[model samples]
Target: MLKLDAYPQGFEEDDRLRSAFTRNLTLHFSDRPAPPSVDGAIRSAGVPKTLIRYWHDPHDVPDDVRACLASWDRLHNEGFEFRTFNDASATAYIAERYGAQQLKAFARCRHPAMRSDYLRLCFVLAEGGFYVDADDVLLGDGWRTIFLNGTLKLQPLCYDIFSSGMVPAAEIWRHDLPTEGRIFYVNNDPIAAPAGHPVLRRALGRATEKLLGNDPRPEIQATTGPGNLTAALVAHARDLAFAGAPFDFELLHDWDAIAETRWDLTYRGDARNWRNMDALGI
Candidate 1:
C-alpha cells in the first residue's frame, strides 16, 4: 500500500480500496491481447500523422512556447509532420466540419484555456495525429520514435488527485473512486491518436455536452480538461473489456523512464504542483 502524510481530506483511503478491487478482478487477465479496434488502429496508421498545436495567433505565441514547437519541428523533420492552428483557422475548421453547434461551443467558451481543450480534441479526431500543449517541451526522440514505429499508446484514464484539492475531503471519500492511486492521471499536455479513435471521439462529445450545458462553473478541468479526457479513456477501456478484450491501455507509469525527462513548464509555482509533489513524496 502507498503511504502519504495526509490525503488532503478524503482521497487516498477510497482510492486504496478501489485499487484493491480492480487488481483482484484483473489479476488473471493480465496477458491478454489488445482489442481489435486498437490493433486495427495500429495497422491503418496514416502520415504524415500530424503534430497539432493551437494558439491565439502565431505572433502572440510566447517565446518559451516557440522553443517547444521548434524542438518538435526538428524531430518532426526527421520523420513526421507538424501543424499549428490559430484561432481563425481552428474556428473555420470546426465550423466547416463539425458544424455550427461545435463551432459555437468553441466560440462561446469564456476562457481561452477551455477553447484550447475543444480545439485539440476536434483537430485530433478530424486529422488523426499527435497533440501537444505549447507550454510543454518534448524531452527527446522517444515521442518521435513511438509515432514513427506506430507504437504510440494511450495512458489509462485516471483522475488527477492534484486537481481534486478543492473538493471537500468528505465528498471525495464518498464518491465512487475508480482506481487506487497507483495510476497516474494521463496528462493532456501530450497526446497521440489515430484519426477517429473512439477515445478522442467520446471525449469530444463529453466536452461539447459540458460546454453547451447550463453549468455556470468555469473550472476547465471538470468540463474539458484532463479529467474529462480521463473519463473518456475509462469508458473506452470498459467498452473494450465488455467485448472480451483485455484492458490493454498503456499507462504513463509504464513510461516513467521517458516521461521523467519531459517537463511541464507551467508546474513551478502552482499550488496543485506542490500538492502533486507532496503526493509523490518528491
Candidate 2:
C-alpha cells in the first residue's frame, strides 16, 4: 500500500511516467480477451508457429549466446519453427518484404541493437509470429498458452527509481504503489502477435520516421527500444478506449519463469549491449 502525493526527487522529475502509468492501469483492468489456461492454446489463429531471433553477425556468435540459443530448441520441439537472421539476411528480408522505405530505415540504424529493435516490428507486422532476443533462453515448455489469440503479447515492466531496480510484477498493479518513484512501461522483446497488428505498425512507423530524420544517430531506447514500444502501446490503448473497443494487446506476466535473457553473455560487457551505447552517449 505504498502511495505518494507527488513525483519524488530522483524519479527523473517528469510527468510522462504518471500519465503513462494511468493509461497502463486501464488496460490491466479492462475486460479484454485473454488466453484460456485450462484447455491450452488454439493453434488455428493466424499467428504462425514460428520463433524469430537475430544477431548482427552470424559467424561470430559467442559461446554464451550459443548455449542460450540451444535452449530455444525445446520450443521447437513444441512445434515452433525457428529462424535466425544476421545483418545481411535481415536487410534482404526487409527489402524484399517491406520495400524501399523500410530498407532505408534499416540502413539508418547505427547499431546492432537498434537494427534488432526495428526489425522485430517489421517481421511481426508483416508475418505473424514470435520474436525473441538472441540471448534469451526458453525455461519451460508451456509456451503454447501464448498462442491462444492474435493479441500482441508484451511484457509489462515497472522500475523503481528510489530502489534503482525493477518493481515486482505482482505488485505493479496495486492502486496504492508509490507513484513518485515508480515508472511503468513495457518491453519490446519476446513480441508475440498476429500479422498486421496496429501496435506493431505504429512502433515500426515511429522507428522508421526517427531513423530517417536528420539525426545521424538516433537515441537507441527512445527511437526503437522499450521507450518507443511503450509510447505506441499507450497511444493504442488510448485510441481503443476512446473508440469503446477492447484492447488489441495483452500484458505478459511471469514470462521470466518461462524464458529469460542470459545477462552474463560476453557481449554485454562490450559495445554490443545497448546499455553500453547509452553510457557512452553514442
Candidate 3:
C-alpha cells in the first residue's frame, strides 16, 4: 500500500504538489505491466495498470527530458522500490490539533520536497532500499543499463565543480575539502551500487550517524552533507584507480561529464558509444 504522511496545510502549495504527483504518478505507472520475471509474480504485478499514466504522453515532456524520464521510471518500477520516513510525531500533533485522522493512519501530504523533507526523504528511501529519483521517468525495456555496465550512474549535481556523474565509495573519501570544512557528496538522485555492497554499507553508516541522529557536528551541518558524501564516494573510487584496481576510470570520468552536461533528458549526442548501444538495440 502507498503510505503517505501528514504535514501542515498550505492550501495553495499542498494542492499544487498533490496535483503534480498525481499527474506524474499517473503518467509514470499508467498501462505498465510487470516484467517477465519473478517480480511479475509478486505483489508489484498487482499494482493498478492505470495508477499513473500521464507519463505515457510524450507531449507533456520536451524532447530532451523524454528519454531520461522514461529510463528512470522503468528502473524505478522494475528493480527499485521507493519510500520515505518522516516526522510521524509532528504529524501526530497536527492530527490531534485539527481533529483529523489518527496519527497512525496514512494521509497524502504534499510531495516531501515542498515540506522541507526532500533530502531526508530521499535518504530514508535509499536507506530503506530505492535508487531512483522521485520524478525520473524510465526509458527502455529493462534495468540492465544501471547494472551490467561497469560504470555507476547518477544525475550529477551541477551545483558542485568537483562532482562525478556517479560517485562510488571509492571516490567519496578523497574529496579535498577545506581544512576547516567538511565535504559531502550527494547521490540522492539516482545512484547505482551493487545491492548489499560494502561501499553502500559504509555510506549508509555515515549517513545514519550524521543525518539521522543527534550527532550533528558543526562541520557536518555547514557542508553539503549527502552530496558531499557522494562526492567522497567518487573520491574513494579514484583511490581504487590509483591502486591499479580493475575499474574503468575513463568511463567513470566520462559519465561524470555526461551528468554535468544534464544528460538526464539531454542525450549525449550521436558520437558517443551510447549511439553504438542504441544501434545494437540496447
Candidate 4:
C-alpha cells in the first residue's frame, strides 16, 4: 500500500505549518476524510485521523512535535498513524548505498548533517523509489493523480536556496563546512518516481560512492542534502546530456510562478500566504 512516513522527529515547527496545511487541505480538497490507503492505516493504528504522524526516531521526536501531534489529535476528528524503523541498516536500497564509512561522514554531525541522514532515510524508504518532503503541499486536490499513477517521485535538490539542506557540501559550499551547512539543503518537497526508473538507482549509487570515499575532500562533503542532491542531479544531467526523465517534474521556486501558477501549492503555504506571514514578522 502507499505509505507516507514523516521524519522520525523535527515536526514541532512543522506542526504549525502542517496545521495550516491540514486546514487548507480540508478547505480545498475535502474530497474524502483521508487519502487512499491512509484511512486504513489510521484505523489500524487506532489514533484520531486528525493527528499528524510522528515517524522519526524516538530521540528525534521533539517535544513540540509531540505537542503538535496531541493538538492534531484533539482538534481534528480524523485519525493519524506513527511508525518507526528499529533497524537503520535495513533501510538501505542499494547494497552499498550507505555504508558505515559513508554514515560517519555525516552521522552524529550537525543538524544539517542529521537532516541529511533524514533525507537519506527517506531515499532509503524510496530505495530510489520515490518520496515527498513534509511541505510540498498540493493544489486543487489532485494528489491522487500522482499518487494513483503508481510512479515514484521526488522533488529536485536545486531550484530554491532555502530547501537545499540535503545538498552535499563539496557540490555547493566548495570548502569544508560546519554544521551550519545543513541549512543549505535541497528541498525534496514533492519528489516522485515512475514505477521503473534508473535515475533513482543511479543517484543512490552515486551518493553511496561519494559518502564512502575517504578523501578529506570527499566529493560534496559526503552530503546528499536536498540542494546538493538537486545540484548533483543537474550536474549529472548536464554531463550525460540526458533529458525527459521523471525527475524533470516541476519545482515551485520563483515567487511569480509560485504565486501565479495553479499548481503553486506547497507545504509552506501559498506564495501570498508566505509573503503575508513574512510581512507579519512572525
Candidate 5:
C-alpha cells in the first residue's frame, strides 16, 4: 500500500511529496526508443495541420480562458490554421457524421468534461488537427514548434492518485499497473492526430459504444475520458505491430513545462469535476 504523509504545507511547497508523486507516475514509452524527431514526425503525419477549440461563446470568454485563446491566436498569426466551433456548429458536425440521435445524446450530457471529451475526439478525427483544452495555456511558441516539427504526441492523463489521496496504492497498482509494468494514461485534453488515424478511429468506436449502451452515470474516465483513450491506444499499438506498422510514442515534455490554471473558482460545486480540486483531496 502507498503511504502518504499529510501534506501540511500543501504539495506545491513540499519537494519530497512532489518527487514521490512524479516517481509513482510512470510513462509507458519511456523504455522504448524515442520516436522520430518532432520535425520528422510532423512531416510524416501530413496535414490539414490545424488547431481546434470548442466554446459556447467567444464574446464572453473568461480571463483565464482568454489567456489560452490568446496563445492559440499567436500560433495562428505565426501560420497555423486555428478553428473554433461553438455549440451549434459542433452539434451540426456531430449530427452529419454520427446522426441526429447521437448529437441529441451528446447535447444532454450534463458534464462539461464529458461533452468536451466527445467533441474533441470527433473534431480531431474529422479534421486531423490538435485539440487543446480552453484552460490549458501553451508554454511558448515552442508548443506549436514542437508539435509541427515532431510527430503526434499523446499527453495521457496521469492517473489522479497524486491529488485525490483516495485510492490505495496497492489497489491502484493492481488495476492500473501496466502489463509492461509501466504505461501512461492518455489524456483527452490535448490530443492531436492525423485524419483517419487508426488510434483515433478506435477511440471514437469505443466512445460510441459506451454512449449507445445508455450506461447511466458513465464514469468520466472510462467512458469519454482518458481511460477509454488509453485502452484504445493500447489496442492500436498491439494491432499495428501485428499488421507490421511501426508505432512509437513519446512524452510532450516534463511535468512542469505546461501551466494549468486553477478551476476552483469556476467549478466549485460540481461533484463530477476533476481538474483543480487539489485542496479537496481530488
Candidate 6:
C-alpha cells in the first residue's frame, strides 16, 4: 500500500503528493493491530522480542564493528532475536514487505547511514520491535528494561551551538536547556516501539516526502536522521495536548552508560562515515 504520486508538472503540488503518501500509510497501518491503549493513554507492552541492526556490507564487517555486533549477539541467550540487513537485502525486504512505493523511496537515500535510518522506521513501524545502530555496544543487562515496555524509547541529546559541542547527558534534563544556544533533538538510534506508534508514523511520512519530493536535496539530518524524528515527536505532543490526550513515549536517561557509540573505529575518518561524506564532498 506504500505510495506517492507523480507531480513533475508543478512543484506546488508537492503537498498533494504528501497527502497521497500519508493516505497510503493509513491504509497499511489500519490493518495492523493498534498499540495498546488504556483510558486515553498508550501503555507500552506487547512489543515483539526482535533486535535489528544494519550495515552497508554484511559480507565484510570490520574487526571493531564485529566486537560491537557481538555485544548484541550475546543477548540471544536472553530471549531476544537478533536480525540484520545489508544495503541490498534491506531494499529487497522493504520491497517485499511494503510494496513498490516504499522501495522507491528507499532507493532515494544517498548513503548507507540514511538507508539505515529509514529502514529502522519501516521495520519498527510494521513489526514492532527494537532497532539499534551497529556502532552502539550494549554494556549490560540493563537493556532488558528498555524492552520491557512497548513505548518508543529514544535517547535525548542537546547540542550547544555556541560552544560547538554537546551538552553533558546529565545536564540535558534541565528545564532551561532550550535557550538560544541550545538545540534539542532525540537520537534515532535505539528505537524501541510497539507497532502503529503515531510518532513513528509521522516521522516516516515526513522523511518519505522529503526524500521523494522535497525541494533541494534535503540535508541528511533534517531529512532522515534525528531532526526528522524530533520534529515528529514535538508535533505529535502538541497534537495530543491540544486534544487533551496523553503523550506516550520515554526519553532514555543514562544511555551513555547502558550503550555507547564507539567513535574510534576505522570508518570514523573515512567516507564510510556520513560526516566525512558531508565534509569531503563525497
Best by lDDT: 2
Candidate lDDT (C-alpha), each: 0.56, 0.77, 0.33, 0.33, 0.57, 0.73
TM-score versus the correct structure, for each prediction: 0.66, 0.87, 0.35, 0.40, 0.69, 0.82
lDDT of 1: 0.56
- Lowest lDDT sum, 10 consecutive residues, model 4, at 45-54
Q: What is candidate 3's lDDT per residue for 1-282, written digit by digit as tens?
A: 111222122211233333322222222222334324232422321121111111212334456554543444443554444332234533543354322332211132222221112233323223323244324445433333223333433332222225422334333323342212222223444454433343444444443333333422213311223433453344344345346565321112223322222444433443222223324443
The full ranking of all candidates by lDDT, starting with the best, is 2, 6, 5, 1, 4, 3
Question: Of the candidates numbered 2 and 3, which has the greater lDDT value?
Answer: 2
Clashing pairs in 5: 38-149, 38-150, 39-149, 39-150, 42-150, 156-185, 156-186, 156-187, 157-187
Task: Provide the lowest-lDDT 10-residue window in model 1.
Answer: 1-10
lDDT, residue 137, candidate 6? 91
Error of 3 at 113 (Å): 6.1
Model 6, range 1-282, lDDT digits (tens) per residue? 221133222222243333332223223323334223233222337677789999999888899998998988766775677879899999988987886767877898888898999999998988888898899999965666675566777877767779999888777655443445556567898898988898899889888888888554557887889878876765665455456675477777657877989999988878889887767765
User: Comparing 1 and 5 by lDDT, which wins?
Assistant: 5
True lDDT of residue 122, candidate 4? 41
Question: Where does model 6 exceed 4 Å of error?
Answer: 1-44, 176-178, 214-216
lDDT of 4 by residue, 1-282 (tens): 101133112221242322222222222222223334322122221111111121334455444434433432322332223222322432342235455644554443233333333444344334332233222222332332333333333322212235653453123323232333233323443444442244344445455555556543332333444433443433333333234333332222221211112333332242223223334442
Candidate achieving higher lDDT, 4 or 5: 5
- Compared with the true structure, model 3 gives a TM-score of 0.35
RMSD of each: 9.7, 4.8, 18.2, 15.8, 10.1, 9.6
